[model samples]
Target: MTATQPAAEAPETAGETFDSLNPATDEVVGTYPVHTREEVEAAVERAREAARWWASLGFDGRAERLRRWKGVLTRRLAQLCTVVRDETGKPVADAQLESVLGIEHIAWAGKHARKVLGKQRRASGLLMANQAATVEYQPLGVVGVIGPWNYPVFTPLGSITYALAAGNAVVFKPSEYTPGVGKWLVEAFEQVVPEAPVLQLITGFGETGAALTKAGVDKIAFTGSTATGKKIMAAAAETLTPVVIEAGGKDPVLVDADADLDAAADATVWGAFSNSGQTCVGVERVYVHERVHDEFVAKVVEKSKDVRGGSDAAAQYGPMTMPSQLAVVRRHITDALARGGKALIGGVDAVGDRFAQPTVLVDVPEDSEAVREETFGPTVTIAKVRDMDEAVDKANATRYGLGSTVFSKRRGVELAQRLRTGMTAINAPLSFTGIASLPFGGVGDSGFGRIHGPEGLREFARSKAIARQRYTAPIALTTFTRKEKTDALVAKLITVLHGKR
Candidate 1:
């Protein structure tokens, strides 16, 4: 994934800078400073002070500021989308969709933070009836956010919005490929919160991100490849700083025998080819029941015929955001063909210099690189399964379990629940990502912790438990004055309450 790799490196000398280019034409979009470790530490220190004031605003006050920020994003939506497209080489419409989704998340986080993290009463249990137990999620002060280039606006804000809502100041380190987008976002936030730098932007290569992990931030929220996520975890471990890693995913799509073949085919094509298959949750593999495998493949190939990658107005998608990924896509296609896979649509020739035409493969071995690795390109491998059971098994075989999709009217939810992934979309492509209330993360190699919904807000917070003594108990078990009879009475109570179960 490009998230884990540095798009470009700057010189180590002071005052060095780098340029962000449009992958389509190699045109310089913008130039940004290569923030050094010293600069990163300085930003963290500034965030520390800002965090105090930001948290003091309380949920309601902070929410108001966020609302204003949301308005800025909405009003300037087209501008940000242009910046996104210029840097990422994605279509303007795709960039707009990404920005709109990011705005929705900001609104949701701001509106619901109080209800999710504010102090709330907790059950005290029978033995502690006289005490009032309460718990609240408190801010972790400052947070370091290492964002990815793909879906730069939406993916990074998944962490930034939630962290801010949880009352933490954020220092975002966007990918070097899309520093212009990052700068735009930070400037928008500054318009609303001019008093303090609640959200800051630091642009550079992987070293800047590494600096953030060790900068003494309370927690680090990273979105990238599992390989890079591991390196970040190791760096964060030096200071025992906590982290929430949203890593790479080789997501799958399952098409059942009784599924709506048309709908499944449409979803598979869009999920695999949209954003040129740069999405972390995009479908990379498909498992279809033998009964409908041929029909489904035909529909997918037919539907994919019109989908092309280019910079033209009619193009469905755009070129590869990172030039290096072009080789990986070609390698996967070449390896699949070598292992007896048949290309139903575009083949190795589809991978051009900047753009990769949508490619669909069949009869591919399950252990092939195209099936097992994170291709992260506009390519998908379709495999036949005897039944839905095999479909589920094959889908769950990958080390990366980030997301999955199912197309079965009757077993949509059933099969979705059985998949070893963090999220699933039933008869839809990337549906979980649009819902602000749903938590998004993955198990196993996809990385740990969450970055959306209430879980996301809590990820940047620490739970503070409080038990207030409202009145003295007749028999205080916690007190040194407790009698042996009290212990006997507690044992009897426990037996009566739980022994039956």
Candidate 2:
């Protein structure tokens, strides 16, 4: 792909910087220099050169380097978790879980990249019988990854690991709220591939990210809000840079009449309130069969009472990572209540200054903001549906179709197949995210392209096809000396071989 025109270097004041603040407390977590467009391009230029070196290392060589990096991550897992906790204000355990998941992806990408992307024999059509064909995936040079703060380590590595495995150097621009975690990752890479700029980090506000999009990177993999994704797509369009967007989602959960009520309630509470409900694939809406609606609601209410958000180790969840999000959570709950919804658990008041208590709202109008928009907080709205068909319909009605869950004993797979989303977990909450082999992404408003498994490896790669002539044909097809009779014979042969079709 051709590089974009040089980004106009924006002027900056000397010593301009930004502070990463802890959401749990109004304390500065870390301070980072505000990188400018010039700096971003310089990083990309270095990455382009580094990409050549990395790709030349080949699969085995690159895999070895990746293994070393993975070892570093494992040895320092606890230390990395501390940075994640300090930046995002999540529990230390949650941070550890995200880091462990990220390590797993690195392992999977290193072990499977060659098998999934290396050249392989491809079938030649009947007309090309004399030709041998093969296809392989090649790196897309340098890639820019703009990641989200929620699950900062696990979410961004979903792209970074695959891009590296596919042989592309990466320039990651993590969310400003979690720059400390990003810095930690880049610093750790130095302990492994210390000689090359294989994985670099650039920190700043949105302008820095925008500058990265306009930079001459070969591709951009972004995971963030739908609105921000649109802006990224537009900026990348200026250079025709390929992009893989993992945007916001208003995922749903379906509770069938035959579902295990106990399990369904438990999964719903955890799925909706985990990480303070900052997950892109979290369950924001619940559709229950009318027969078991009352029972499911009661169970969820009971399960949610114990789910509280605080900065302490004993808290089940943590505060909203982005303090501004508190207002949005409060507004969603207020709207749901004003629309005649009943708060069975925490109400609008539950959205505190730093932490948002697990709030469950029922009887909320389907078209209300709480149900319609992406309320990325620890809040869920449950609605009773006439049947499974209605449940599926309501689940598919939303513009955002990311991840969803279905609780059914017999019809688990059936309901999962009907819903339009990237992934679905049946009778469990968020099991897909743990599986490194499954592709992770969504369609429509949730954005397109994947970031895990084989699909992810291909997302940052370009498919190259090769056709070699194994033997000369008796009848020449591409020679100036070929006669008209030869052409007729070829046409007749094709007619006999495929005309009936």
Clashing pairs in 1: none
Error of 1 at 233 (Å): 0.3
Task: Identify the runs in model 1 with alpha carbons over 4 angstroms from their true place.
Answer: 1-14
User: lDDT per residue, candidate 1, 1-501, as tens digits?
Assistant: 111222211123368899999999999989888988988888888788888888988999999999999999999999999999999999999999999999999999999999999999999999889999999999999999999999999999999999999999999999999999998998888878877777888889998899989989999999998999999999998889999999999999999999999999999999999999998999899999999999999999999999999999999999999889999999999999999999989999999999999999999999999999999999999999999999999999889999999999898999999999999999888899999999999999999999899999999899999999999898878779789998999999999999995
**Per-candidate local distance difference test:** 0.92, 0.92
- lDDT measured at residue 298 in model 1 versus the true structure, 0 to 100: 91
* C-alpha positional error of residue 203 in candidate 2 after TM-score superposition, expressed in Å: 0.3
* lDDT per residue (tens digit) for residues 470-489 in model 2: 99877777889999998898
Clashing pairs for predicted structure model 2, backbone only: none
User: For model 2, what is the C-alpha lDDT against the true structure?
Assistant: 0.92
Q: How far in Å is the alpha carbon of 6 misplaced in model 1?
A: 33
Backbone clashes counted, model 1 = 0
Relative to the true structure, candidate 1 reaches a TM of: 0.96
Relative to the unseen true structure, what is the C-alpha lDDT of residue 365 in candidate 1, on a scale of 0 to 100?
Answer: 97
